[model samples]
Target: MVEVRPLPSADSPLVEAVDLAKHFDVSPPWLTRVLERQPRTLLKAVDGVSFAVPRGRTFSLVGESGCGKSTVARLAVGLYTPTAGRLVFDGTDLAGLNSRAAMAPVRRRLQMIFQDPFASLNPRWRVRDIVAEPIRAHGLLSETRAIDRRVGELLELVRLTAADGQKYPHEFSGGQRQRISIARALASNPEFLVCDEPTSALDVSVQAQILNLMKDLQRELGLTYLFISHDLAVVYHISDYVGVMYLGRLVEWGEARSLFRKPQHPYTRMLLDAIPDLEMTGRRRIPVRGEVPSPMNPPSGCHFYPRCPFANERCRAEVPLSITLPHGGEVRCHAVEEGRLTEAAVRQALGRGASAP
Candidate 1:
C-alpha cells in the first residue's frame, strides 16, 4: 500500500511548466525532399505552454484531440523530452537529472496512468506481478513474501481482494483493470501522478467510480495530479484549475469554477457552449465551428483565427500575448484583451442561434 505523507504547503508549485514546447520533424524522406526541393517541416505539437500544479491539487489540461494534451502529459512525466523550455518538478529541473541512477528517486515519486487500461497492463502478467513490478523494480523490498504482502495491501487499498491478485489482466472488468493500474502507480508511493485520460475508456458509470476512487485516494494520500483530458465535463468535475489549449497553445486558463462560470476567451466560451445541459434549459448550444488546422501549417497569428467568431484583420495579423484577467486567470485573445468580446456581447451574438435562457 502507498504510505501517506505530510504534503508540502500550497504556497509553492509541485510541478511547473515554463514555456514548454515539443516539436516533431515530419518532413519528407531525404530523396523526396531533394526531388521536391522541400525544406524540413516541423510539427509544433506543444508550443510555449506554461502552467503549475500546486502541491496536493489537481491541475488539468482540456482541449480538442491533437491539441497536444497527451503530449503535455507525457512531457510532465519525462516520457518525452522538450525541444525547448523547462519542466521543474518539486524544485528540481528534470533536464538536469540525466542518468537513471540520478533519476531513480525522482522516478519513484512520479508515476503515469496511461489512457487505455486495456493496453497499459500486460495481458500475460498476473495481477500480482503487475502490481508488484514497480516495488520490485525500485527495490523497495527484498524478500518475495514481503513484496507479496505489499502487493496484497495495495490491491486491498484499491478495494480489490488479496485473492484477486491471482487473476490475470483479462479476467478483470475495465474498471477493475483501472484499479489495478492505480494500484501499480501507488506501488512506489508516488507524490505526483500524470493521468492521461485515466477514466476515458470506461462506461459513464464506471468513469464516475474511477473518478471518485481517484479523488478519495488524493484526499487520503495527499497525492498531486496533472490530469489531461478532452472531456470538459470530466475536467469540470475533477480539476481545481484548468488550461484550455488550441493548436498547441494555451488559449485560456484559470480556476475551474471561474473559467466555467465566466469563460473569457472565444475558444473557451465555444467549448463551454458545447456542454449539454440535461435539464433542458433554454441555454443555447453553440456547435464548435471549423476543424483544428494542421500544426505544421498553422495560422501565422492566433491559431484559432480561422474559427474564431470575433476574428478580425488584427487578429489574423498579430499574435495575442497572454494577458491577465481582472479576476485571476490568463487569456490569449485579441478580442478579450481589447474589451471587444464582453460577456453580454458574446451572449447576444451566440444567442442568435441559441434559445432564450
Candidate 2:
C-alpha cells in the first residue's frame, strides 16, 4: 500500500487541490436529441485530481493537449462550475461562497495569466488601461491617477517600460504582451495565480525572460502558482513540483527533480523522452509512438496500457494501486507495485542521465 503524507500538514502547502474534478454534460436538449437521434454524453475533463503547492513554490501541470491540464486551470480559478468536487483555497471550501457577491473577496485574492497574450488582452484598450482594469475592478486603488501610477509600477516590476502602457496590445512583441498579462494578474496582489501556458507562444529566448520574471515576482510577492503547460522543458525549468495528467487523471506527480530523474509511469517516461536530451553528444530522442487515446473512450485498467511497451494481460484488466517508493514518492504502476518489473528496466528505458527529482 502507498504511504500517503498529508502535504499541507506535513510541509505546510500553500495550495491544495483535494479530489478536484470537473465534469461537463455535453448532451443536447431532449427535444433536439429526440429529433437528431442523439444520446446524452458526459465529458470528464478532470477526474479526482489532487496535489498541493508549498508556499512560494511552483506546481506545474504538463501533459499533451486536451488532457485536462487546462481544464484543471479553469476549474481552479472557478471559470467552470465543478459538477462533482470542490476547491479549497487556504483551507476554506469554495462551495461555501454560494453567491457571486460572496465570492468577491476570494476573487480579488486569486488571478489568472492566460495563454496567448495577443488574444487574452483587448486590442482596443491601451496597455495602461489593460493593466489598470484589474485595479479598477477590484477597487485596489482609489484615484484614477493612482491607478495609472500603480500600472506604471507594475510595468516596471515586469521589466517593461512604464510608457509602453500607453500603446495597445499590438504595439508590443509577444513577450511584452505576456509581461503585461503578468502585470495585470499582479495588479490585484493575489496570493495565488493560475498561469495557463504563460509562455508557450513566445520565442524560446523570450520564454526564459518571462519565466525569470515570474520566478522573481513569486519570490518577491510570496505567490503560489498553478502553472499549466504541455512543455516538459519549460516545466522542468520553472517548477519546484510537477504533476503529469493523461486523459483526465494524474498518473504520476512528485518533486520536479525526482519525477524527471525517475519517472515511474510509462506515460511519464514517454513525456520525458519527448524533450531534447542536451547531455548526450549525438542524442536521438525517441518520440512518443502513438497519439493520445480518445478521452470519450479511454482504455480500461491502465489507460496507458495500449501504448505502454511493458504492459501485460494483468495491466489490461486491473488497475494498479499506487505504491510508495523508497526514492521518496509513490508510483501508480502495477508492474512496479507487484515487483514484476525490476528497476533496471525502468532505468534503461529512461536513460543513464535520469537524475533524482
Candidate 3:
C-alpha cells in the first residue's frame, strides 16, 4: 500500500525544491558523434534551483523564454524526473517514490495547467469527459451519477455551468477552454497547481480574467501554486514570493514587494527597468545588454557575468554563492556579496537621484 503522510503545518511550505536540476542530452547520435569526432552536448535547462511555496500561497518564477521556468514546472509535477536534487511535496521526497503505484497518491494531489489551452484539451472529448478524466483515473467517484454531479460542481467552481461541459473543446473560446482546463485540474482535488504560462496565450483582457479567477480559487480552496511566467506584471499581481531565473539558476528571490521595490541583482534590475515607467519617475532605464548565452556552454563562473555591468575578474572566474539579504531573501551575485553593489551605487547606475525613492 502507498504510505500516506500527514500534511505539514500552515507555517511550513507545501512544496520545496532543493538544488533542483534538469539536464538534457542534446548531442548528436553516438554513431554520428563517433564519425564526426564531436563531443557529447548536455543542455543544463535547470541548474541548482531552490525555492519553497507556502501552503495557500503563490511562488512565481519569472525569467526570459529559455531560462528553464517551464522545465521547473514540469519537474514539480513529475512530468520530467530531475537530473539531480530533491523535490519534496509536503513531507515526502518525490524522487524517493520508486514506482508509478507509489507515486500515485502524491500525484493525485498535484496538477498542471499548460501554456496553451487549445492544445492541452482533446479535440473530440466533450468538456465533461475532459474534466471528469482525473476523477475517474483517481477513482475518486465510481458511480456514474456521482461522477456527473461532481463534474458539474467542478465546472461551476471554475465559473462555467454544467451545460457547457456537454460541448467539445473546439466549440469554446480560448478563455473558456482554459477554464475547462482549470476545471479538469481541480477535478482531482489537487492541493498544489503548477501553472506554466497559463495566461500568456490569452488576450491581455482575458489574461486578467483568468488571473482573477485563479486568485479567487486560491482563496476559496487554500491551494498552493508554483506559477511560471515571463511577464513581470503578471508575477507582480499574483506572487507572494518571486524568484528571478537566469541561465537555469535563481539569481535573486524574496518577498515580491521588497524585491520589486529594491532589486539587488543586476539582472533583476534590468528586468524591472524594462517595465514601462507609467508613474514617470524619470529614472533612466538601463537597456539590457547582450543576448543570453546558450545553456550548453554557459560561462564558467557566474552565468550572468557576460552581461553584468558590475562584473569584475572575480565574478568571471568564480561562481557566486547565495548571500542572505538584510530585509529578506537571497541573491547570487559577486557584486552584491562583496558590498560593491550598494543601494546608492544601484541608484546611480540607474541615473536615479538619491531622493527619488
Candidate 4:
C-alpha cells in the first residue's frame, strides 16, 4: 500500500512541474535516414513547460489541439518519461520511478481519467470488473465480499446504482460509462486525478453533469486535478488556475480569474477572445489570426511572434523571458516583459482594461 504523508501544509503546491519537456523522434528508422542522407527529426511535444496546482485546486491546461496539453498530462502520471526537467507530486520526485511495475504504487495515488469513455472502457468487461480492477491490483481488499462492497460504494459515490456494476460496459450510455471510469479511478482512493478532456465527447447537458460530478468528488475527496481541455468556457468554469501552452512552452499561467480578467500573453488573450460570451454585455472580442505553426519546425525568437499583433524586432529576434507577476505566476511574452504595451494599447487590442496585467 502507498503511504501518503500528510500534505506538508495547506499553502504548498500539490504538484510542481518545472521545465518539463518531451521530444519525440518522429524520423524514419536510423538506416532509412542514413540511406536518405537526412538527419533524424525531433518533434517537441512539450518543451520547457512549468506550472503548479495546489491541493484541492484545479489547474487546467488549455490551448489549441496538439499544443502538448495531453503530453503534459501523460508525463505527470508516469505514463511517459520526460526528456528533461521535473514533475514533483506532493513533494515526491515523479521522475525517479525505475520501472512500470514500480510505478504501480504511484498509479494508485495518481489516477488518470482518460478521454473517450467508450474507447477507455473494455467492452468485454463487466462494470464490477472494470471498477474492481484497481482495487484488486493494489490488493486493497483480500475477500470477495469486501471487494464487492467497495465497488458498490464507488459506484454510488459517482451517483451510479450499485446494481449497475453487474452489467456489461456496452449496456451503459456514454455518460454512464464515464461514471464507471470515475469509479475505477477512485477505487484506489487516489488524491490526484489527471483528467484529459473527459467531457469533450459528451453532449452539452452531459458535459455539465460530468463536470459537476467531478467538482463534487473533488470537494468530498480533497482531490487535486490537472484538467486538460481545448474548451475555454469549460476550463474557466472548473479551473482555479489556468496555463496557456503554445507550440510546446507555457506562455502564461496564473489564477484563472486573474488571467482571464487580464491576459498578459497575446496568445492567451487570443484564446479568450475566441470564446463568444452570451452574457458579457459590452466586451469586444478579438479574432485569432493565422494557424498554429508546426512543432517540427516552430518559428524562433518567440513562438507567438508570428501572429502576435504587438510583435516588434526584438520579439522576432529573441525569446522573451518570463515576467513575474506581483500576485502569482508569470507570463512569457516580449511586450509584457519589456513594459511596452500601454494601457491604451491593451484596451485598443482587447477593447478592455485588464484586472491583472
Candidate 5:
C-alpha cells in the first residue's frame, strides 16, 4: 500500500483553489440547436481541481496543451469566475468580491504575466508607458517624476537599461520584451504572480536567463507564484510543488523532486517517459499512447484511462478520489490506490517493450 501524509491546514496556504471548475457553453445558438434537435453542450475546461500554494513558493501546473492549465491561471487571477468552487487568496474569498471596486485590493496583490510577450505589450506604446501603466493604475504615485523613476528601476531590476524604456516593444528581442512584461507585473508590487508559460516563447538560453531572474526576484521580494507550463523540464527546474493535469482534472501533485523521482499516476509517468534522452542512445522509451479524448464528450470515470496501459474496469467506471501519499503529495489513480501499481512496477513496465525514441 502507498504511504500517506497529512496535507497542510486550510488556513496556511497563501492561495488555495478548492474544487475549482469552469465550463464553457459551446453549444449552437438557441434557434440552431432547436432546428438540429441538439442538446446544450458544455466544455469542461476545468473540473474539480484543487491545490494550495504556500507563501514564497512556486506551485506549477504542467500538462499537455488543452489540459486546462491556462484556464486555472485565469481563474486564480479572477479573469474567469468558477462555474463551481472558489478561490481563496490570503484568506479572502474572491467570489465574494463581486465588483471591480471590491476586487481592487486583491487585484493589486495579484497580477499576471501573459504567455505571449510580443502580443501582451502594446506595439504602439513606449516601454516606459507600458511599465508605468500598472504603477499609475494602482495609484502608487501621482508625481510624474516618481512614476518615471519607478519605471526606470523596474527596467533595471529586469536587467534592462533605463534608456531602453524610450523605445517601443517592437524594437526589442523576444527575451527583452518578456523582461518588460516581468517589469510591468512587478510595477504593482504584487505579492503573488500568475505566470502563464512566461518563458516558453523564448530561446533556450534566454529561457535560462529569465528563469534565473525570476528565482532571484522571488528570493529578494519573497513572492509567491502560480506558474503554468507544458514543459516538464521547466517545471522541474523552477517549481517547489508540481501538479499534473489531464482533461481539466489534476491526476497527480506533489513536491517537484518527489513527483519526478516517483510519479504515482500512470499519466504522470507517461508524461515523464515522453521526455527525450540527452545522449540519443538506443534507450528504451515508454510510449504514452492514445490521443486525448474530447472534453465536450469526455469518457466516463477517469479521463486518462483510455491511454493508461494498466487501466481496468474500475478505472472506466468510477472516478478515483485524490489519495495523499507519504510524501504529502496527492494522486488520483485507481492503480495506485489498489496497490496494483507502484514505483518499482512503473520502472519495470518502462523497461519492458520500451521503444527507441
Candidate 6:
C-alpha cells in the first residue's frame, strides 16, 4: 500500500525538489548506433535542480527556450517523472506513489496550467463542459445542476460571466480563452498550480491582465504557484522567488527583488541586461554573445564557460557548486564563489555606481 504521510505544518514548503534530474535517451536504434560507431545520446533536460515553493507564494523559473523550465513544470504536476532525485509535495514523496490510484489524492491538490490556451481547450466542447471536466473527474460535484453552478462560479472567478459558459472556446479571444483555461484548472480546487508560460501567448496588455487576475486569485484562495517564463519583466512582476536556469541547470536563484537588484551569476546578469532599460538609466548593458550550447553534448566543467567573460582555467576544468549568498539565495559560479565577480566589480564594469533596477 502507498504510505499516507502526515500533513505538513503551515511553515512547511508546499513543494520541494531535491537534486531533480530528467534525462531523455535520444539515441538512434541499437543497430544504427553500432554501425555508425556512435554512443547513446542523453539529453539532460533538468540536471540536479533543487528548489522549494513556500505556501501561498510565487516561485518563478526563468530561462531561455530549451533551458528546462517547462520540463520542471511538467515534473511538478507529474506529467513527466524524474530519472533521478525526489519531488516532495507537501509531506508526500511523489517518487514513491507510482500508481495512479496512489497519486489521485495528491493530484487533486496540484494542477497544471499549460501554455497556448488555444490548443489546450477542446474546440467542440462548450466553455461550461471544459470547466466542469475537472470537477466531475475529481468527483467534486455529482449532480449536473451542482456542477453547472460550480462551473459558473469558476468562470466568474476568472472575470468571465456565467452566460459565457454556453459559448464554445472558439468564441473567445486569446486572453479570454486563457481565462477559461484558468477557470478549468481551478475547478479541482488545487492548492498548487504549475503555470508553464501561461502568459507567453497573449499580448503585453493582455498578459498584464491575466497576471493580475492570477495574483488576485492567489491572494483570495491562498494558492502557491510554480510559474515558468522566459520574460524577465513578467517574472519580476509576478514572482516572490526567482530561479535563473541555463542548459538544464539553475545558475542562480533567490528572493526576486534581491536577484534582480544584484544578479550574482554572469549568465543571470546577461539575461537581465537583455531587458530594455525603459527608464534610460544609462547603465551599460552587456551584449549577449553566442547561442546556447547543445544540451546533448554540454561543455565540460561549467556549461557556461564558453560564453562567460570571466571564465578561468578552473571554470573550464571543474563544475562550480552552489554558494549561498549573504543577502539570500544561491549561485553556481566560480567567479562569484571566488569573489572575482563581486557586486562592486559588476557595477564598475557596467560603467555606473548606481544599483541595478
Alpha carbon lDDT of each predicted model: 0.91, 0.83, 0.92, 0.89, 0.90, 0.91
List candidate 5 stretches off by more than 4 Å.
1-11, 279-282, 343-357
What total of clashing residue pairs does each candidate reach? 0, 4, 0, 0, 1, 0
Candidate 3's TM-score reads: 0.95
CA lDDT for candidate 6:
0.91
Summed over model 1, clashes come to: 0
Question: By lDDT, who's the top model here?
Answer: 3
Give the distance in Å from residue 20's predicted Cα in candidate 2 to where it truly belongs: 1.4
In model 4, the worst 10-residue window by lDDT is 1-10
Error of 5 at 345 (Å): 4.6
Q: State how far residue 266 of model 6 sits from its true place (Å).
A: 0.8
Native-referenced Cα lDDT, model 2: 0.83
lDDT of 3 by residue, 333-357 (tens): 9998888988788777667778986
* Candidates 3 and 6 compared by lDDT, better number: 3
What TM-score, over all chains together, does every model reach?
A: 0.96, 0.90, 0.95, 0.94, 0.94, 0.94
Residue-wise C-alpha lDDT for candidate 1, range 58-167, written one tens digit per residue: 99999998899999999898888899999999888887788889889888999999889999999999999999999999999989999999999999989999999999
In model 2, where do residues sit more than 4 Å from their true spots?
A: 1-10, 35-38, 344-357
Model 5 poorest ten-residue lDDT run = 1-10
Maximum-TM-score candidate: 1
lDDT of 6 by residue, 15-119 (tens): 999999999999999999999998999999999999989888899999998899999999999888999988999889888899999999899989989889999
TM-score-better candidate, 1 vs 4: 1
